[model samples]
Structures are given as structure tokens and as C-alpha cells.
Target: MQVNLHDAKTNLSRYVEQALDGDEVVIARAGKPLVKLVPVDSTPRRRQLGFMRNQGIATADVKGDFIDDINAMFS
Candidate 1:
């Protein structure tokens, strides 16, 4: 279904519900199709912390002057 920009803005939630129900939504501007609203991937992307934990990222690897430089710049 297609909706003009103004009406789409007013009933955005309703249109989003429709899209979530597997209906294709096309937003238009001056009768020209602009964008499509579709359902997003419900699956959450997997993530882990400490990307550099094993990449020689210990405190000994950090520059000794790094903290002093940062403090000097911020203070």
C-alpha cells in the first residue's frame, strides 16, 4: 500500500503495524514513491566484549605517557 508523506506522518504507527504484519508499505512524495517500510530482522546480533583482550593490549603495552597526556589535554 502507498501513502502520501503527510498522511504517513500522521498514521505512522498504524502503517508500521501493517508493515509488521507482512504488508508492504511505500511512502510517497508528490505522487513519487520514496521509501519502503518493512519489518526488521528480529534476531539480535551476537556480540562479545574485550576485542583486544588477547591482542597484546595489557597495561604494559599502553604508552606510559598516555594517561598524563590525556589528563593534560582534558584538564
Candidate 2:
């Protein structure tokens, strides 16, 4: 839905709710489109317990060579 800047400002909360409900909101200035407000996909990420429990221990073998490791990735 297209709305003027003034109307968008006045009913900002309502427009936000509409966008969150999967409706597209277009804010216009002088009949020209300026921006669009759309809903972001907010699907919850799965919870994984202890995914990095031993990662730090594995890195202990490295002796202050973080910069070399990073540069090797680029090369």
C-alpha cells in the first residue's frame, strides 16, 4: 500500500503491524516512491547445546599464529 509521508508518520505503529503481518508498505514523497517496509522472516533458529564445547581446547595447539591462519584463508 502506498502512503504519503505525513500519513505514514501519523499511523506509523499501525503500518508497522501491517508490515509484520506480511503486508508491504510503501512510503511516498510527492507521489514518488521513497521506501518500502516489509516483514522480515523471523523464523526461530534451532537451539544446539555444546556445539563448541571443545573448540577452544583444539585451538590451544596454535601458538599465537592467528594472523597467519587468517592470511592463509585469503591465499
Candidate 3:
């Protein structure tokens, strides 16, 4: 729903509640749409921090041995 800037400002709280309920809210200026209010999904990803410490990264898992090759080329 599109609303003028002044009206949007006056009913800001209601618009925000509408947005939270997954409704699209468009704020317009001089009849031109300028911004949209949408709900943001704030869900955290599952991760295990101890997994990294318990199973440390292996050196062989690395790609490209540029340091040794570069030194050999210079020598």
C-alpha cells in the first residue's frame, strides 16, 4: 500500500506493525514511491565452535604451494 510521506510519518507505528505481519508498505513522496518497509527474518545459523578446535585444519587441505615455488624460482 502506498502512502504519502506525511501520512506515513503520522501512522508510522501502524505501518511497522503491518510490515511485521508480512505486508508490503510503500512510502511515497509527491506521489512517487521512495521507500518500502519489509520485515527482516532474523534467524541464527546453527554452528559448533568446538568442531574447529577439536579437528584442527590439516596442512594438506590447503591449495597452492606458492611460497616454496616462488623461492625456488628466485634461487
Candidate 4:
């Protein structure tokens, strides 16, 4: 679907919905195609838990040290 710049601006939300629905949207200026609208991939990536489990870092010691430092700060 092709639309003129003024029409595209006037019906921006409709065009965006059409684009998200997988329809090809083209914006034109003086009948010349200027840009295409497409939906972005908005999915967030999942973080890997326990990524440092085998990295030789002691989790319990780190937690204890952090708590001790926080207690010292508040004292």
C-alpha cells in the first residue's frame, strides 16, 4: 500500500497498524517512493541464570562481604 506524505502523516496510526500486520507500507513524495514502514522486533532477550556458577567466584562469600560492607557503612 502506497500513500502520499500528507496522507501518511494524517493517518499515521492506521498505517502503523497495517505495517504491524505484515502489510507493506510505502510513503511517497510527489509519487516517488520515499520510505517503507515495518514493525520492529520488540521482544526482550532472556538472561542466562547461573552464568558464573563455574567461574571460581564464591557467591556466599561475596554476599557476606557485601552485607559486612553495608553494615560498616551504616554504623
Per-residue lDDT for 1-75 in model 1, tens only?
Answer: 999999999999999999999999999999999999999999998897887688884467345748888788889
- Would you list the clashing residue pairs of candidate 1? none
What is the model-wide C-alpha lDDT for candidate 1? Answer: 0.92
Error of 1 at 25 (Å): 0.5
Best-to-worst order by TM-score is 4, 3, 1, 2
TM-score of each: 0.58, 0.55, 0.61, 0.61
TM-score of 2: 0.55
What's the number of clashes in each of the models?
A: 0, 0, 0, 0
Q: What is the lDDT of residue 37 in candidate 1?
A: 100
The predicted structure with the larger lDDT, 3 or 4, is 4
Off by over 4 Å in 3: 48-75
Query: 17 in model 3: Cα distance from truth in Å?
Result: 0.4
Q: Least accurate stretch of 10 residues (summed lDDT) in model 1?
A: 57-66
Pick the winner on lDDT between candidates 1 and 2.
1
lDDT of each: 0.92, 0.90, 0.88, 0.94
Candidates 2 and 4 compared: the better one by TM-score is 4
